[model samples]
Target: MKLLMAAGIALSLACISAAEAPSNYETYYGGVRVDSDPRLLNHYNRVLAYCDREASLPQRGSPYPYDTWHILALRSCLYRYSFVDRGVHSYPANWFWGHVFEQ
Candidate 1:
């Protein structure tokens, strides 16, 4: 039950953050343009999968949790892929927060 509650809260936060996130801004990583939406989506999905797997692992004495790392990775991927000027927001279903709860 605790896990479910935590997941719910995390999801709520993700959705809220997603709502406020900038949209349709061209993204670049290491001075290189990120021109492919599919590539970014793939990276986001991979990070999410890693987060899920790590969340299921036994807790350790580390300073940062696995979820933290994975979430950051996902965020970075999103940051690198999203466009701010284009204002393109057609596929909400493909967004990270859109289906985070379904995992």
Candidate 2:
């Protein structure tokens, strides 16, 4: 029982350390779970913020129009999630079994 408890504790810690923020949800489709680097998340956030202002948006005829920043930010969030899943979480291929089995 002691050995079982110790193993459980160690595994739970590993899961906790690997878990990513709920907002970080980018890499779902490609079977690519990227554990996000917090540094990268900060960088993406700053980039999105700087481009959010009306004045910062590109002119109407420019490729970097108002919508550009919105789209980029959305993409960034997706990437953050994907990176987190891939790089941090050890959600094995058989995680569905846990859902079905674990109460």
Assess every candidate by TM-score.
Answer: 0.27, 0.25
Per residue, candidate 2 scores C-alpha lDDT tens digits across 14-102 of 44322234343334456532325566557545644443442234441224433434444434444444433332233443365656777
* lDDT of model 2, residue 51: 34
Candidate 2: lDDT of 52? 40
lDDT of 1 by residue, 1-103 (tens): 9999999877654442222122333445343233346675455456445544554444521234334444344444444444222232323334655458668
Backbone clashes per model, in order?
A: 6, 17
Per-candidate local distance difference test: 0.43, 0.43
Query: What C-alpha lDDT does candidate 1 achieve relative to the native structure?
Result: 0.43
Task: In model 1, state the lDDT of residue 103.
Answer: 81
Off by over 4 Å in 2: 1-35, 54-103
